[model samples]
Target: MALNKKPVKGMKDILPEEMQIRDYAISVIKETYGKFGFTSIETPCAESIANLTSKQGGDNEKLLFKVLKRGEKLDVAGAASEEDVVDFGLRYDLTVPLVRYYSAHSAQLPSPFKALQIGNVWRADNPQRGRYRQFMQCDIDILGEASNLAEIELILATTTTLGKLGFKGFEIRINDRRLLKAMAAYSGFPEEAYDSVFITLDKMDKIGPEGVKTELLENGFGESCVERYLELYQGLEKAEDGVAYLADMLKGVAETSVTDNLREIIDSVQATKTAGFEMVFDATLVRGMSYYTGTIFEIAIPEFGGSCGGGGRYDAMVGKFTGKEVPACGFSIGFERIIMLLLENGFQIPDRPKKIACLVEKGVEGQALCDVIAKAQAMRETGSQVLVVRMNKNKKFQKEQLMAEGYAEFEEFYKEGLRN
Candidate 1:
């Protein structure tokens, strides 16, 4: 009989070779996040339907992997759920559940709490290049205080960490959703135009100016207003030169509410960051989340096919449930995507050996082999992979067999590992 074993279409098992790179990326993220006063926390993989669906923007809820209630008991809770659910659905992303966790436990947390979360997130969306149904997301968020300073710090922290991890040619694109709203007002678009405008803006980089224009027109955007927005990306502006661009866009806008909020954003970016990431006042960046009441960003490396990761402010998410608004902003990096970039581009990360194959002659010396096994067991206790090599015995024949198997590292006969 043939063996039947393979991962499902959108999932993959991490092989030993790939695991070295994966662990290194995770360690780099954890250590980097720790220095910024962000404490690590984890929530359940399954979250209640209410928490998952409640106020999550975009098509995120559509991707949720719902867990069926046991033994037809779902009928008992039908139409009107007495309790939210015990057999909850798999979490779509860490943000929603993290917000739920914070809102429920806010009294126990310090004012202006910062958290670092790293975990697997599932999306039922069709897998494509660099996108998997199950993937890892690493995020750091600050909650309970509205501070533009937090945005600056988060950008610096992420760039610094990625730099330390040996990435190059990457830039952090920063934009204030407040400023997008200001532009929408300046252009005389309405409140209902909010979601569509941002989503269209996000596709600007991907679809080119003309394509975006066509899309907007197809989506019912007036031609004259779209022309005014397309001017932001045409010029060659570096990170340092973006302030002038922002001032030009916001100039003479009577909406002081948006302008004043934007001044805070400008000051936050201008106050001198030691990290080498460019911040552009991109009026074009509308992070797809509806509740994003402030700054938004996406990090991209030029060599990669897509933005490495992105996230932004979502202040109204928690307020819908708890009735008290919580100020919050965060970003998530595509963990597996980063690994692919490193592996493909020769980015080196710390590596550890995952397997050790030990070999022994069949009938030569059981007692002598016992000593070798003892040493191997000691290494195994410390989490080293060790496999005792068993073979048909005749000392001379077995010796040749071991060498042919590339087990010459065993010439030390038990002193060193297989690779040695």
Candidate 2:
């Protein structure tokens, strides 16, 4: 059988055009985050199955791509369960591996370590427009910081990076896990049922309030709880400031500080942000990750009509690896999605070096080639991007292709003098 040339399902071969944007975006991300004191770090793409399934990743754990035992350890025929045969899995996201990395390196790293990690993650999810089973995730996380400063800095850094990438007028929809629980609690939901209620509430954008109500009622929740739970959303629509309204409503049910801290984060970002984005309180926002203990946020771009990326505070996740809790929070950009949007919009890299192509006539060697090579090198040293290649017979078509690759100026060399 002929070898298949296509990539496996849910994966893709990035073409040169898209790779250019991806490379530029990564440079911008690293430069912007680095300015905010985040140091670059790396972790293995594969992690132990035990840590991946520690219940911190929520729905992503279900989508893990497990790796079977290797060589002598392989006992698929005699294994009674998956655990008996599988030992590791591809990381579903960066946060889990980051926490594990921090647990092992905390002794040598600085307190409140800020890390910038960019890598591929795998999930056996249904591939869609911008989502792939295998895709890149760009994450910035801060560990060992117990104050709202972490949240504030994270929001500012992420938004500034997006703005540098030419994203504007986007929405940073903010919410708190505590507020979600507090709303459910005040609405008379059982403590154990908060997750179930949240699972339905998360669908509000898709199914609408009536759909959420029907689902909640069908799931055996009290109609009164559903009514009261949704009533808060109704009030939020009319309130000038939803965060203040929620703060007042959840006064005694939730801690005063949770709402206060969240409000302060929104105000701080709005006041100091150098980006063209809005920070709005979204009580209905429930980041799927159960590990998020406090402020949760998602970036909404009007073009995507869905979340571009998101993250939140997960103070207790490190405790699962070590015995003691450490404060941690992260924000991940939907890397693949951002690349897709930029490609769709025909985005161009700003201030790029002038690209020039030098095509040498076939069989033109000796000092003529040496002169051409010397000229290209000199141009490169002067900050020009030069591509030197043997001239193709189809010179016009070759120039057209080179032009598409951002090579606007071209020089042709033959036995005679060079022609531009």
> Whose lDDT is greatest here?
2
| Cα-lDDT of candidate 1 | 0.73
- Lowest lDDT block of 10, candidate 2: 411-420
Cα deviation at 400, candidate 1, in Å, is 14
- Reference-based TM-score of each model: 0.81, 0.98
Error of 1 at 369 (Å): 3.6
Candidate 1 residues lying further than 4 Å off, grouped into runs, are: 1-4, 76-87, 227-241, 251-276, 351-358, 363-367, 373-420
Model 2 stretches astray by more than 4 angstroms = 416-420
Among all candidates shown, the one with the greatest TM-score: 2
| 225 Cα displacement, candidate 2 (Å) | 1.5
* Candidate 1: Cα lDDT at 371: 84
What is the TM-score of candidate 1?
Answer: 0.81
Local accuracy of candidate 1 as per-residue lDDT tens digits, 130-204: 888898888998897686667766776777778778876667777777677666666656768867876777787
* Whole-model lDDT values for every prediction: 0.73, 0.94
RMSD, one per candidate, in order: 5.2, 1.3
Please write out the lDDT profile of model 2 over residues 1-420, one tens digit for every residue. Answer: 999999999999999989988999999999999999999999999999999998988999999999989999998889999899999999999999999999999999999899999999999999989989999999999999999999999999999999999999899999999989999999999999889999999999999999999999999998899999999999999999888898898888999999889889988999999999999888889999989999999999999999999999999999988999999989999999999999999999999999999988987899878999999999999999999999998999999999989999998888676445
